[model samples]
Target chain A: MNDMARLQKQRLALYGWMLVAPALALMSLFAFYPAIATLWHSLFTRGTTRRPSVFAGIENYNDLFADPTFWIVVWNNLIYAGITIPVSIIFALAMALWANAHIPARSFVRSAYFTPTILPMIAAANLWLFFYTPDLGVIDQITGFFGASPTNWLGQPETALASVIMVTIWKEAGFFMIFYLAALQTIPPDLREAARIEGAGRWTYTRRVLLPLLMPTTIFVFVNAMINSVKLIDHLFILTKGGPNNASKLILYWIWEMAFAYFDSPHAAAMTILVLLTLGLVAVIQFRLVEKRTHYR
Target chain B: MNTALASRPAKRALPDFDKVLDALGAWVLAIVWISPLLFATWAALQPSGTALGLDFSNPLTFENFTYVWNAVPWAGYFANTVVLVTLILAGQLVLCTLAGFAFARFEFRGRDTIFILVLLQLFILPEVLIVENYAIVSKLGLFDTALGIGLPYMASAFGIFLLRQAFKSVPVELEEAARIEGCSWMGVLWKVYVPAAKPVYLAYALVSIATHWNNFLWPLIVTNSPDTRPLTVGLSLFGAPETGVDISVISAATIMTVAPLLIAFLIFQRQFIQAFLRAGIR
Candidate 1:
């Protein structure tokens, strides 16, 4: 290029670096550096007094594979994510549709649908803890009026994860609903009117036209819901703490326990590396979809 | 034509069954969805004994609130949360805004690559790095401080991404005009770009405040003592199994911890929802 062009480019480069320096520095310190550090740390065993720090070289990964608890937690997390993601998405869409439709007390309905998103998961857990409490709990009291037996919802291993799943759905659906609501609002009224003119039933129009239009939103919500299932296990701290033999334990929550409770830093690091890999893969897929969707615009 | 016009009036006057059912369904779901919060309110306002029964006719009292308020060092927790959220928000705004402006405006080598790397943080959240982050925090002697709690979140990928989009949308003429006025890089940003992105800043601030205000896992891991513990952590401790699950008192504590955002949401429900709507559009 010309000398003037070269100098302008150089100036741009310098100014760009100067502007982004603070953000880059902080990200390196916290995210990028720690990510590499976690992977590096995962390659070694924790040191004790007698044995100085030495390389274990994938021994932690081997242990993680062999460890039954790790496998159990992995399965539990898959189950958690499997159930919560789809159910929450469906509930979100339903609630959004209902909220957006010509209904009585439209604002109140929308508020009710969206209110749960604001409340802290810990607080929600605390509230649900009361609901899941034995015969004294509201669920049991209502069930008892119909001659049903009272069940210990949170105590039993079989029901514990499911109970937590219920809370996850409750907490996540409203947040996802907002996105669907936004998507719904963007759909032209004329399309619905035209569909009616074409003698399309509600079911046919929704299935053929509306849902196709909402595909981008559905993918976005699904990806977010998946990521949420990975990261959003805060309610577990109050609700279950991976209780009843690790039935409700998610991968992230398991890592926390390994690192802090057991003080097994290396194993936790290995787990962290695994989670990062999974997240990385998921991110790649999400970006591909987002790229297509945004580019399509 | 006369028959058709008469039929239109008759149909309009008739009660629409489907519409009535839809409204009923909406009300039922709304009631069911909000029943947990309703239950918590019921439990908090009544005596613990009657709360279990779902009794609403009993004498209502603020005894649980008073008990919860006096029982915990809630003021300390609230102070920590306010300080932490403010710090994180300030840090995010400054860092994200500058970085966003750079990506949006400047033509530089490896710009796209660096921006993509920054966006990689969208998926590799700080929460996932807690194991190493804890070590990093303690190494920096920032353990149990609000800074430690807020540090990792300050460089938010979401914020940077949102602000970059906002900055890109601001007409280039404004920036050029500011520069023509002999404004420095920061001056152009201040005089033109930042002012133009005000609505975006407000929307982002809402998301940041709500997210940080309810943020649990990181602060929970980083902060050990009550001195630096945010409301979520404090409330978790109060509701732990060992704390004796006095439902009424725990409900009271939960309400107090979440009250500020909840109250704000109840008042500015439109803005709150709109902010989330805006943020989610990405």
Candidate 2:
């Protein structure tokens, strides 16, 4: 009986491995291998027909550090993250509160807020492009009524990044609102009643009783928004192409330009490594926060 | 419980001034949020010259849509998008389910470490690794192909993690009952676990479909020609200012590309929102 049990356990282990093997293989092919290859490739020099590629250590990193465009892209991404994260979170919270309230046409309101989230970023950008056209755009048309001069929203360096940021906020707020809405539903309604009986106003209840309970959801949305600040540059492809002197150029776009457009794979790899490091730091922070949150539960 | 029950009537009876203001504010924001798509729809329906005009009485026409349809290979792009999304969802379902079951029930060595490694893929997303992934795709001779675009995303860490959570929540007794009935592990998984996790599967499927349908950047990089180009890349190429297609035409194409998902979302708004909510909570 003991021998049979051992054999059965061994067979089950084999089955388990077999079950997981396909995913492991694909992940290794795509995720693990590419990640290590990115790190490895970052340390080398870009090869050309005339000269073969060779080990270059941190030369590529140093080059990127010296490039002014690199710094500009980094600054733009930072500002992008800074503005989009908090603003979208705030909008999401407000929308969630209002949507969850005893409002008129509640489902309609929820769907309206969420419709943008369902639209592709590229599609959203295409629609917004018409609004940002120099003189005949929707914003210009509106401002024209008040006699404001036509402003090139996506053309000028000063307003270009801000214009991009506006689109990001518009696209993201609704998506984050869904999370806030979900979190709001999970909060027991009695908390509000208890707070009200204690003479808490709506603002007081929201600030004291609501926001604290929504902390975990807030963190989750914040992390997603942060990742999106890097990943959601599809709009840039449409609205600005990181043009008008690359004012709106994000890190990921710049990386794509370097690797594909400029054929400078090493530098793109180096920048990718930097992005990976930043994301890894974020993952660690998120893990720690989630751990603490679970303990609270 | 008595206080809560007693307060309900009082809460509804009071016509709070703030409540009225709150509803107004909510409606205003909702309009502002949805205005872009509304504007796009308005523009797309207008003739070429009247696209940007605010004249609501302007006669709408299907000319722009027809022009865009004939102008671009939208049919091919739509087919590519449908196939790509379907292929991705199918691959993700199978791979994630099997892997999730293993992690949920199997006692294997190195399981925790391997699970962590899989979880790490969540952060190291394909977009971030585009440079190396592109190189890998070329090395595997999948460049400019739909398979190349789909393969990298097939083994999704998010899907695997979600399914693991779902499967873990399945009652152990159900599995034991199946085992006592002489069901094999595969049989048990299909007959018991999969059925029990149907809601989870539905939620994950909705999320995955929306995600892959809207995915752009990697597809933009991997696909170089119209043959494999998804709607997003196709739309971008068609709408590039250099193409100089009229704004109405571009809007028509934009609406066309997003219409399927947008319509589905409208009809199934509750399911879409719930799916996102379910995906987000974890």
lDDT of 1 by residue, A123-193 (tens): 98988987899898988988999999999888889999999999989888999999988888888777866
Query: Residue A18 deviation, candidate 1, in Å?
Result: 1.3
Q: Which candidate is the best by lDDT?
A: 2
**For model 2, how does the per-residue alpha-carbon lDDT over A1-297 read when each residue is reduced to its tens digit?**
999999988888888899999999999999999999999999999899999999999999999999999899999999999999999999999999988888779899988888888888899899898789989998999898899999999999999999899889999899999988878888887787788788787789989989999998999999999999989899988889898898999999999999889999999999999999999999999999999989988
DockQ of every predicted complex: 0.61, 0.68
Residue A59 displacement (Å), model 1: 1.4
lDDT of each: 0.88, 0.90
**What CA RMSD would you report for each candidate?**
3.0, 2.0
Candidate 1 colliding pairs: none
DockQ of model 1 vs. true complex: 0.61
Candidate 1 residues lying further than 4 Å off, grouped into runs, are A1-9, A291-297, B1-15
Please give the lDDT score at residue B274 for candidate 2: 88
> Candidate 1: deviation at residue B122, Å?
0.5
